[model samples]
Target chain A: MKVAVVKYNAGNVQSVIYALQRLGVNPLHTEDQQEIRTADKVIFPGQGEASSAMDYLRSKGLDQVLTSLTQPFLGICIGLQLMCRHSEEGDTDCLGIFDLEVKRFKVHQHGFKVPHMGWNRLETDNSQLFQAVENPFMYYVHSYYAEVGIETTGITDYILPFSGALQKDNYYAVQAHPEKSSDAGQTILTNFLNI
Target chain B: MLTKRIIPCLDIKNGRTVKGINFVSLVDAGDPVEQAAIYSDAGADELVFLDITATLENRKTLVELVRKVASKINIPFTVGGGISQKEHVSELLNAGADKVSVNSAAVRDPQLIDRLAASFGSQCIVVAIDSRYIEGHDIVHTHGGSRPTELETMAWAQEVERRGAGEILLTSMDHDGTKKGFACDLTRKMSTTLTIPVIASGGGGSAAHFEEVFNGGKADAALAASIFHFHEVDIMDLKKELQAANIPMRI
Candidate 1:
């Protein structure tokens, strides 16, 4: 299976590439339209500011390419956020693959940090993404989270219940870093690969 | 519930993992890549690689080592020591480091935190503060705790967080290598003070010490070296104890 990770001025793709390699697949890390479009699976993993990432993606004309790709495209972290209608990070408009709006985590108290950074359990996962695994631990490091809605395939509680994973048609994305996540994360990647 | 993170910090000197007693008397632990793999497989939440001798000449070598370990392990790895410039941060992040920790650089140029946070996003910039109590006040130290600065530890931590650092990797120079336990009291203060995650580093002797840091220290993460490096404490066993003690862990 040909796997290609979307690369731009967004975030780090090395861990995602390494994760795929451990699964015995040497995936291509590229921003090339043809390479990304032609790949059997395209993993869009990003970890930077949403507006800046969108600017880079639009500048490289990847915005259209990403939205149009019919194959299984997995968006991680900011990738998942960018797939929404808009983000509060920079008040920037996004790809709108899913009719979603990304909001910052509601820090309830003083020590309630913006970025919910650490390992947290995944609850209520019925998608193929959670295949071979029950509610498990996944590493999350982000301030913005997708609100649970119709497209929410999984729900997680941090400051409040939010979409842990979103699925709409061929577009699949998760707020957690499945690559940085341990064994269960690898299983999610494996399941995506099988998809 | 946030799972308390157990991070194994590897002090690197001349491209080799070394452990120090009270920030001095360096001893070789093993190869960086090999030790990193062992920790990752042993269920360490995150791994920290600090170049003890972070000279300009050896920095390139550290990035190379980071790539080697990042390719092998599937967990978040933070690299620090002698990271001064934006380019150094980019080099480490490009080399597969999930986060780039800056200590003296951030203290010297406070705006460095803003620049890094702006450029790479606040999620990847970690401001490491090596501190020791001098007289009656906690003072921040630089260059591996050899020099004490006028900046107060808590004050500096607050400044760094306000300047947009993702997390504070706070190491208590006073309690480091003591093997007695972590500085839980101050750690709890820092954790309560900062809205961001405070990784309590130093003076981890056993699982009980970790428990104290998590409960009293209220630290989001705890990093230790000698105990884990010399096999005095195993990561899996430590997690078992922490789990049994009602500390939420990834066990």
Candidate 2:
């Protein structure tokens, strides 16, 4: 099975590459439209601002290409947010793969911090990503979260309950970093690769 | 929903992973690449690689190790130690590091902080403050907690933020590895004072420790090394506890 990680100006591609290698899969990392379209599975991964990332995708026409993919595709971190309806970061319109808007964490009156980084537990997953694990913890490092109801497969709280993972049609996106999530993360990737 | 995160900190000396207790055990953990793989598989939310050897001979190798590790993990990783210039920050970011953290370098030459923030943008630059409570003051430490600088932690933090630091990794030299609990008082103050993200490092002994940091300190995130490495606390369990405590976590 072939997996293609969509490449752009975003960082965190290296970690995704390493993650696929460990799973005994040598996936292609590229921004080329044809390669991404032909892969058995595709992963849209990134670590950076939303507006600039969208610009890169739009420049290469990858945004339209990603929105049209028929195969199972996964979005991680910023990738997941980019699949949402819109983002507060850089105030960009996302791919709208999922009817969700990514909003910045509102700082609580008592002074809650943003960029909810670290590992938190996942609960109630029915998707392929949780094939072997039941409500396992995953690694996450993000300040913005998607506000999608029902499509959410996993949820974590910082200031309030936020979407952790979302599923729509053949597209799946997780705000958490599954590649860095250890066994549980690996399990999710393996499941995605297999699907 | 907020997810729980488990992180492993790798102290690098001459491109090798080193671990010390109370910041003094000084044992080789393993090859950084291999250990990083181990931690990532064991379910580390993120990994922190701090270059410990201050010698010039080791700085070059540390950068290469970061490149190697970045090529292997599929997670958000932060690299610290001997990072003082925009060139150093660029090299690491170009090497695939998502974030570059600077400590003593930022304190010594605050301009370097502004330069990096301008070149790479503030989101990619993280300022690590190693603080020690000295006579009711949060004194910034340099050279691996061996020396004290004239900079105050709170004051320097604000300065870095103004200069465009995306986040601050605050480690309490007094509470680190001691596991008594985080410097909740200090973390709470910084989180309240700063608008950027605050990662509370040091003194996490149990799952409750994480809850305490989040509830009492109001920290955005709590980073621990020994507790997770030694199996004293499980990441999922910790998240459950945090969730139970009504702290928003991913579940």
Candidate 3:
């Protein structure tokens, strides 16, 4: 399969590319609209600020290209947040693919840490992306999360219950890093590839 | 629920592991990439590679090692040691390291934390604090805990957090290498004081020490080098023990 990873000014795209290579798929890492549009699948993976990332996307005209794509697209971490309607980080607007708002974790108590940085179990629905995975734990490192909504397919509890995985038609997004999530995450990526 | 993390730290010198590791599955124990893969497959939540390469020429080797490890290992890993500049962090992150830990450099220039956090998001910035209790005070130390600093341990940790550090890696010099146990009191103080997750490093001898650090120390995660490198405590077996003790582990 010809997979195109939407690249911008974000970090950790190399790891995504490596993960796909481990799965026997050499994904093309590109921000070019034509390459991304023509690919069989597109993976939007990143780790960076929302406003700066949105700015880069607009500068490259990827925002429009990404929103208009009809192929199966996967968004990871910041990619998932940027796919939402808005983000609390930098108070920037995002692509309205999921129709959800990304809110920062409020540390009301002492034990509740921001950037919920560790492994957490997922409460998943019947989404095809989670076909064989059963409430598996995934690696998470983020302060802001997409609030659980209609597109929500998986929920993970930290300070509050947030959307772990979201699916709406062809657009699929996950708040955690599936590339670094070990076996269960590899399964999710494989499922996405097969889709 | 967010589970407690078990991190196996590897010290690297010129792109090779410094300490000898006794993993039967590993062909070359000095290979950080192979060791990291073993840890990941054995249920380690994350891995940390502290590049101790002294010469500037060997720095390229660290980046290459990071690239190799990121390609081979599936779990998240952090690359630390002598990382002071934004350019250095940019290179390592571009090479595919999930997080980068800053130690003595962060202590030298406090604003470095802010600059790094602004340039690269806070999620990738980890401030490693090495402290030793001296005359009823927890004082921060630099250069592998050999040089003493004026900053207090708790105060420095809080400062880094306020300056936008995503996490704190606290290492107690007194407990380290003792093999008695982790500094539960100091770790608990940092964990309760800061809103960021604390990874307690130092004296981790047995699985019970991990349970103590997680429950009593209130550390979000625990890191150890010798005990893991020497095979005194197996990662999987240690995690099972922690799980049996009602401590949440990946296993």
Candidate 4:
């Protein structure tokens, strides 16, 4: 299967590429519009600030290319946040694929970390991305979370319940890093590839 | 709910695992990549590879090792030990390290944290503090905890947080290698005081110790090297025990 991982100013896309490689799929890490559009599956993995990422995407014309893709597209971490309508990080506007707003996690209570790092369980709906994965623990490291909405397919509670996975039509986004989430994560990636 | 993490730290020297790993299943225990995969498969939440190589030439080998580990292992791993510059961090991250940790360099030039956090978001930058309690003071130590600094542990931790560090890897010199237990009081203090997660390192000897660190220490995560490397504690059993103890675990 041809998987094109969207390349931008984001960090950690290499890990996603490695994950795909481990699954026996040689994914193309590219910023070229044609390559991304032509791939069987497009994976948008991110690990950086939203505004700068959006700016890079806009500069490369990938913002438009990404929104127009019809194939099964998956977004991870910052990719998921950027898929939202807006993000409080740098007060940046996103691709508006999910029509949801990403809000920074605000917790004054003890034991509630801002980044929400490490392993957390996912309460998934019947989304194809989480086919075999039921409330399994996945790795999460983010300070902002997309508010749960109608399109929300997975919910995870840290400080409060937020969208862990979102599925709107062909676009699937997860706030956690599936590449780094071990077995359950590999299953999710395999599901995405098979789709 | 986010479960407590169990991290197995691997000491690297010139692209190979330094200490002898007693995993019977590993084809080459010295091979960092092989060791990493075993740990990941055995249910380690994350892995930290500390490169203790001294020469500049050997440091380049660390990046290559990171790339190989990233390609093979499915879990997130952080690379540390002698990472002092933004360029070094960029190389390691580009090679697919999930996070890069700064220790003595961060203590020397605190602005390095700000610069790194500015370039690459705070989520990827970990500030590892090696501290020792002396005369009713938790003093920060540098150069592998052999050298001491005037900076207080709590004050330095708070400063790192304010300067935009994502996580703090606190290794208590007092408790490290003792196998007695983690410095629960100090870890709890750091965990409660800081808004970011605190990874308690140093004195994890048994699964019960892990349970204590998570529940009593209030640590978000706990890291150990010898117990895991020497086959004294199994990650799966540890997680299960932690879960049975009402400490949230992935298993």
lDDT of 4 by residue, B1-251 (tens): 88888999999998989999998898887999999988888889899999887458987898899899999988889999988899999999999999999999999999999999999889999999999999999999999999999999999999999999999999999999999899999999999989988999999999888989998999999999999999999899988988888988887
What C-alpha lDDT values do all the predictions have? 0.89, 0.80, 0.92, 0.92
- Residue B57, candidate 1: Cα error in Å is 2.2
Query: How does model 3 score by TM-score?
Result: 0.98
Write down the TM-score for model 1: 0.95
Cα deviation in Å at residue B166, candidate 1?
0.7
For residues B127-228, could you state the per-residue lDDT of candidate 3 as single tens digits?
Answer: 999999999999999987889999999999999999989999999999999999999999999999888899999999998899999999999999999888
Could you report the DockQ of all the candidates, in the order they appear? 0.71, 0.37, 0.83, 0.85
**Between candidates 1 and 3, the DockQ winner:** 3
Q: What RMSD does model 1 have?
A: 3.0
Residue A106 C-alpha lDDT in model 2: 86
Error of 2 at B186 (Å): 2.9
TM-score of each: 0.95, 0.81, 0.98, 0.98
Off by over 4 Å in 4: none
- Candidate 1's residue-wise lDDT over A66-172, tens digit each? 99999999999899999999999899999999898999887676656768998988874567888886538899999999888899998778888888899998899
